[model samples]
Target: MNRLTVRAAIHVAAIFAIYLSVAMLIPAAVDLFYDNDDWQAFAFSAVLMGGLALAVALATQGRPPPVSTRFGFLLVNMLWMTLAVAGAVPFMISSLDLSLTDAVFESVSGITTTGSTVISGLDQAPPGILMWRSLLSFMGGLGVIALGLFLLPFLNIGGVSYFKIESSDIEDRPFERFQIFTLSLIGIYSTLVFTCALCYAMAGMNGFDAVNHAMSTVATGGFSTHDSSFGYYADNMAILWTGIVFMLIGGLPFSIMILFVLRGHVDALRDPQIRVYGGYCLVFSLVIAIYLTVANGTPFLQAVTHSAFNLISIITTSGFASDDYSLWGPFAVVCFFVATFLGGCSGSTTGGIKAYRFLILFELLANGLRRLIYPNTVTPVRYGDRTIGDDMQRAVILFIAAFLVLWAITAMLLGATGLDFITALSGALTSLTNVGPGLGPIIGPAGNFSSLPNAAKWICTAAMLLGRLEILAVLVIFTPAFWVR
Candidate 1:
C-alpha cells in the first residue's frame, strides 16, 4: 500500500509488459506470412505497448527497497491485469472487431488457461490471432508455474507453506540459485512443447496446427486451432494419444519433474501427490470407459482411448473435447463434472481443488473416524513422509470451503443473468476450476461462451482470475485487515 511497494509493482509490470510486447511480433510475422490483414493489429499493439512499457520501465528503474507481503499480492494482481489489458488490445484493434468485454473475457480465459472461448469459427480466423492465443497459454502456463514455485508459497495460501518448508530444508533445495531453477524450468517446458509438436506433426497434423496444439497440450491450456477441439482429429488415434500423454505430463508437479528428469532422482516420481493424481486419473478413466462401453455400446478399444483422453483433459483442466460427451447421457455428464474439481498435482499447470488437497481431506476424515473408535490413539497425518501441521491442515480446509462458497455465489450470479440451472452451475464450476466449457446446449463442449451476456462474461473473468490465483491470494487483498498495518 505504500509508495515504494506501488512503485516496485509498477516496475515489474512494466518490464513484463515489455517482454509481452516483443512476444506480439511472433504472431505478427505469422499473420504476414499468411497474408492476413490482422498483422497490422499485432504490429500496432506491439509498438504501442512496447513504447509505453519502455518509458514506464525506464522511469521506475532503480534498486527498490525491501517490500512486504502486501507487495507480492499487489504486484501479482496488477501484473495479471496489465497482461489481460495488453492481450486484449489486439483483439479490439483487429478485424475481429470484438467489444471490450468479450476481448477481456477471451484474454482472461486464455491467460488463465481456462480455455473458454467467446470467439468461434476459429478454422477461418486469422493465423496471428490463433498463434497469439496459443502464445498466451504457453506464457500463462509458465507464469503460473513460477508463481506456484515462489509467490504462492511465500504468501502461504492453501497448504502451500508445506511446499516451501519442504523445498527450503537444508538437504532438499533443488538449486541454490533462483536463476538456475528458472533456467531448468524453461528448458524443461520448452523441450516438452517441442517434443509434443513433433509428435503431433508426425501424427498427421499440419505444422501450424501441430505447433499450436502442442503449446496448448503441454500447457494444458486447450486452445485448439479448430472449434471442434481435438475432435477435428477424432479419427487420428495417434494425435489423440499424443495429447493424452502430454496433458498428463503437463499436470504433474514440475519440481518433481525437474528432479526426475534433470537430476536423475528416480524417487521423485514416487511423490504421494503424483501417486494420488495418477490414481484419480486411472480410476476415473476406467469408470467412464466402462460406462461408455456398456451404456453407449462404444467399442472397448475406442472406449478406452476416448475415455482416457477426454477424462485426462478435464482432470488436467485442459478443456479439450474429442467428442460431445454431454450427449453421452446424464451419467457421463455427472462424471465429467466431478472430474472438473479433481485438478492435477500442485505446482502443475492445471487448476482446481488439486489432487493433494483431496488426499489430505480424505486422510483427515479417516483419522477423525478412527478417533471415535479409539479415543486415546494419536495419528499424525502425513503427505509423503512429512507430518502435516495443524496450520497446514486448517489452510487446506479453509481453501476448500472458500472455493465451494465462491462457486455457489458465482453460479447464482450467472443464473441472475438469465442462464438456466445447468448452464449457470457448470459455468461457475468451469470458470472456478479453470476447466473450460460448461454443460448444456449453451456453453457445453459443442458450444461456446459467445452467447453469454456481457455481465456474465465479466463475472466469469473474475472467477477465472480468482481460481487461477488459488482464490485466497486475490481475496486476501480486499480484506480491511490486510491494509491496516
Candidate 2:
C-alpha cells in the first residue's frame, strides 16, 4: 500500500471519529434533562474527541487515493481500536470516576457489542451514562453490519464472500448499486430499532427504558439500564417476549432482512444459515426448558419462558438475562456454555463462530464421510444453492481453528492471572464470542466484570477486538507476509 492509501485511511477514520463524537450529545441532553452534572463530562469528551479527529483529518487531508485491500484491513481494525478509546473518555471523566482500565474495558465492551460491563450500580447511575452504553452498542451494531455486508465480503474474510451480490457491469453501475444496498441496510436497521422500541413501550417500559432497551435489543448488545438487566422486567411477560422477538430479529442475516424488505419475499429467510440458527435456538431452548421443568420441578411455563429467553440471549449473543440460568442445574450450565460458541447468523451483529461456519463445517464432515464410503465417486459440498469452493472451505476451517486456538490461549492467560478454571474458561469464551456473561459468580449472568484485575480486563478487551474482527482480519496484519506486501 502507498503512503497516500494509509493517509486516506487515517483521514476516513478521523471522519468516523468525528461522527462518533456526535453521539455524545445524546447523553449530554440526557444529563441536562436529569439535571445531572455529568453533562460536562460528555461535553468535554465530545470536544476533545472531535478536535482530535479534526486535527487528524486536516493533517491527512489531500487528494484522495485508492485504499488498497491491506489498507482496508488496517483501517478497519484501527478505526475500531481508536473509536473504542475515544468512547472511553466519558466513562473516565464522568462522576462514576471509573479507573482508566475500567473505563477502557466498559468502552470496548460496548463498542464491540460484547455487553460486558464494569459498572455495578446501573439502577442509580446517571441516565447519561446508561444512554451512552446503549448508544455505543447500537452504533457498534451498525458498524458490524456494514463491515459484514461490504468489507468482509470484499476481503474474503472467513468465507463471507458467499453472500456477495453479483453485479452486471454492462448493465448496472457498481457505485450506485453499493449505495443503494447500503441505504437499504440502514433503512431496514432503523425500522427494526423503531419498531422494537415501540413494542417495548407497549410492553410497559417507559419512554427512556423502551428506547434504551430497543437499541440494545436490535443491536443484540444487551446493555440494560438496570444492573439486574432484563431480570428487572421479569414480571412483565410482554417485555421479555418483546426482547426475545427483537433479539432474534437482530441475530438473523441483515442481507436477508434487506431482501425481505425490498423483494417482499421469504426466500432469504430460508437461507441455510438462518434455518440452522433458528433450529439451533429452538432445539436448545426446548432442551433447557425441559431440563428446568423435569429436573428442577420449576413451573413449566416459567421454566420455558426463562429457558427460552436466556438461551436465545446467549445463542444470539444478545446477553440479556431474564434470570440466571446457571442456578438451573449443571445441565443448563453446560448448555449455556456451549451456546456461547454458537452465535447468530453471519451478516448479523451477533458474534462467535457464526452459524454459517458451523453449517460449512458440518457439510465438510458429511462430504468427507461420503468420500470415504465411495472412493470412486466425487462429491461437491453445497451451501444453499452454491457449491462451496475448496478455498472458501479452507478459509472457514482456518477461521474455526484460529478461533479455538485463540480461545484456549486467552483462557490460559486469564488462568495464569489467578482466575479460577471456570472463571477463566467462561471469561475467555464470553470475550471471544462477544457474549456478555460468563458462568461463574464473578462474571456470570448475575454478576458483572467489575472485580477482574486490570490485566484481565485488558486481555478481555483484546479478545473482544480480535473476535469482532473475525481473527484473520486482525492477525493477518501481524504476519511477515502481510507487511512484505
Candidate 3:
C-alpha cells in the first residue's frame, strides 16, 4: 500500500488517540481536586486508549493512506465505531455499573454529540464521569467540524463548495497550508469554548460544571451536568440567551469567522449561510414562542425561555431543554422535529440536512415559477447570486431522498427490536440525523435512553454512526464493487 493508504486508518486513529490522551488527563486533575475515586476510572481509560493509539501509530508509522471515495466512506464509518468503542471504555470502567451495550451506546451518543444517556442518576454520578461525558461530546463536536473541513467537502454535500476556503481539513491541500488552516480553526474553536465557559460560569453554574457544559453547549452537544438539563435553572432567564448565542457561534462557518477575526472584515459575518441560518432561528423561534404564549396559554417568560433555548438547540441540532417539550402539544413536537432536518450551516458542528440546501431549493422553486409565468424572463436561480446548476439541484434532491429512505429503513429495523411506534420512529430519525434528543416521553429532550433494550441499543448505535458519516459516505462501502479490491 502507498504510505497515505497505509496511514489512512491511523489518521483517524491518531486523532482518536490524541483526543483520548488529552481527555484522560482531565479527570486526573478533577480527581486530585475533588478527592473522587473516579480518578481510577480516568487512569485506566486513558492508559487503554493511549496504548491502543500507540499500537496503531507505530504499525502505520510514516505511512498514510491516500483516501479515495470508497475508502473515505469506510474510514468515516470505522472512525466513529472505533471512537464509540474507545470512548465507552471510561464509562464502562467507572463504578456506574453500565453494561457493555449501554456504555457503548452512551459513548456513541457522546462522540456523535447525540447526548442520549443511559445513566439515570446523573445528579449522583461522579464528577469525573460527567466531565468525561461532556468531554466526549466536546471532542465529538470537533470530530464533525474536522470531518467537514476535511471530508464532507470532498463528498460535495449540500453546497460546501462555496467555502473553497482551505485548511488542514481538506485532504488534497498541501501540508503546510492544511496545518495553517487547521491550527487557525482550532484556535477559533478553542476561543469559543473558553469564552462560553467563562460566560456560563458567570451565568450561574459552578466553575467546573460551567466549563463542562460550556464545551458541550458551544459544540451544540447538550451534555449537561444535571439530569434536569437546562430546566434545572428555570429561574435563570439570561442564561438561556447566553446558550443561544454560543449555539449560533457553534453553528457558524469557521472560515468566515477567521476572516472576520483577522482583518475585522465585518461583512464576513454576512456570509450567505450565516444570514440564512440565523434568519431561520429568528423567524421560527418567534413563531413558536408566539404560539406557545397566545395559542397554548404558556406564560410569556417561560414561553420565550423554552422556545428560544429549544429553538437554538434543535435548529443547531443541540439537544438541550429548558422545559419538557413533550408537554408543549403536537405543533411544538412537529416543529422541533422539522428543525432537526434543517440543521445549522454546512461548516457547523450541528448535524442534519442543513439550511443552505433548503435555501437553494426554495430559490430554485421560485425561479421555476417565474420562468413559467413569463417565458421570456431569464431568471437565474441563485444562492447569493451564484446560479444554481442542474447537477447541484439533482444532488440536493437525491440527498434528501436518500436521507429519508435511510431514516425509514433504520426506523423499521429499530421497530423490529420491539420498541413502541413513537420511540422507534423518533429514535430512528434522531439517530439518523445525529440530533441528540427525540420525541415522546422516554427519549424526549427531558428523558434518557437507559431504559432501552440491548437490541435497541445496537440499533441506535448503528443509527448514530450512520448520521455522523452521513448516509452516502458509509452506504457506498456496502456495494459489491467497494470491496472488490
For model 1, what is the alpha-carbon lDDT of residue 79?
85
For each candidate in the order shown, give its overall lDDT on alpha carbons: 0.89, 0.88, 0.78
Candidates in order, TM-scores: namely 0.98, 0.97, 0.91
Superposed by TM-score, candidate 1 places the C-alpha of residue 405 at a distance from the truth, in angstroms, of 0.7
Residue 439 of model 3 has an lDDT of 87
**Which sections of candidate 1 miss by over 4 Å?**
165-171
Query: TM-score of predicted model 1?
Result: 0.98
Model 3 worst lDDT window (10 residues): 165-174
C-alpha lDDT of residue 360 in model 3: 76
Per-residue alpha-carbon lDDT of model 2 for 1-485, expressed as tens digits?
47777788789889999998998999999999999999999999999999999999999999987646787788888889888999999999999999999999999999989999999989999999999999999999999888887787777778466566311211243335677878888899889999999999998999999999999999999899999999999988888889989989998888777766686656656788888889999999889888888898988788778888999999989899999778888888999999999998878999988888988899999988988999888889888786888778888988999999999999999998899999999999999999999998999999999999889999999999998888889998888887673
Native-referenced Cα lDDT, model 2: 0.88
Show model 3 residue runs off by greater than 4 Å: 1-7, 11-15, 65-67, 158-162, 165-176, 367-381, 389-391
Which pairs of residues have clashing backbones in candidate 2? none
